[model samples]
Target: MSSIDSQTTYLKYREYSDLLKVILYSSQSVLGAVPLIYHLKHNNQNIIFIQTGTMGGNVIHYLISNGPPSKKFIELKRLTGDYTFVDKIGTDGMSLYIPILELEKSNLDFP
Candidate 1:
């Protein structure tokens, strides 16, 4: 519990992929999806909103699944494995917006 963590609002992601699959990968692998779930589980999040604006499939999978996207979960799974926990990974064609402040906050184990 710290000042910045309290002032935080929503966790926004931009990459485009099956929200469900991405969430899964993010959870087990500590990818983009981990931040939101971590905040929620810790009661540190104010909102869990994707920044990509293109969402539908598994809007809440990050809190459900325990692994990354499966081959069946994606049409081109091979193209996404390398990007397992990255911004452009798994995305068909999307951008990533990682907040510098938020990212810095992730490294700090708040007391």
Candidate 2:
């Protein structure tokens, strides 16, 4: 498994779980969807803005922590024409709007 401490731009999975609890409680809803945009300070250095939403009962987390684009993902993005995955987050990172579960299952990485 990858080391959570090595990640600089995104929160650990457990942290996300905690944040999801807070959002669910504060929003006071358990049926529909709640979208959230959070500005997080990472390691007291970089400021990263993460976008997430709750759908049905699942928390969908966008990942912007893959660092830079790998040649394989770039080619896949080009072939698929899914430029939406290249969204800019904060000042430097690019975002990929994949569901948290799918992200965990796939080995693909993006910028």
Candidate 3:
């Protein structure tokens, strides 16, 4: 896993956290009855935000059964073919906070 400059990232994101919170909360309200913001935590030491999969299962259930199907979700469902190993993809539910410096080193083109 790539190490992140937590301080830099925190500083960059801190100014927008309130705006993000408002957008997220509003979206959650629109979603209605879905588990969206499942326990948000921030580490004072690292200044990194962490959100655990407390109600992730509920969210998945809501998305699969009740929520409006998105194009990506439909594609993912088709690719996984029964939701068996869907969780095994990528970091397997683990979130990675990569620094901008590290992202710049990659071949991916982003602004």
Encode model 2's per-residue lDDT on 38-95: one tens digit a residue.
3333333222133343332232333233342221111112122233332222232232
Model 3, 1-79: lDDT tens per residue?
Answer: 1232221121123422332343234334644321221111122121222121232221111001122112211111222
Looking at model 1, the pairs that clash are: 13-51, 24-67, 25-68
lDDT to native, each model = 0.32, 0.31, 0.22
| Range of the 10 consecutive residues with the lowest summed lDDT in candidate 3 | 57-66
In candidate 3, position 97 carries an lDDT of 16
Ranking by TM-score: 2, 1, 3
User: lDDT value for candidate 1?
Assistant: 0.32
Candidates ranked by lDDT: 1, 2, 3
Better of 1 and 2 by lDDT: 1
- Comparing 2 and 3 on lDDT, the stronger one: 2
Backbone Cα, N, C clashes tallied per candidate: 3, 0, 0
Give candidate 2's TM-score: 0.22
Tens digit of per-residue lDDT, candidate 1, span 23-92: 4455455334532322222234322232221233122222222333232222223334332333323445
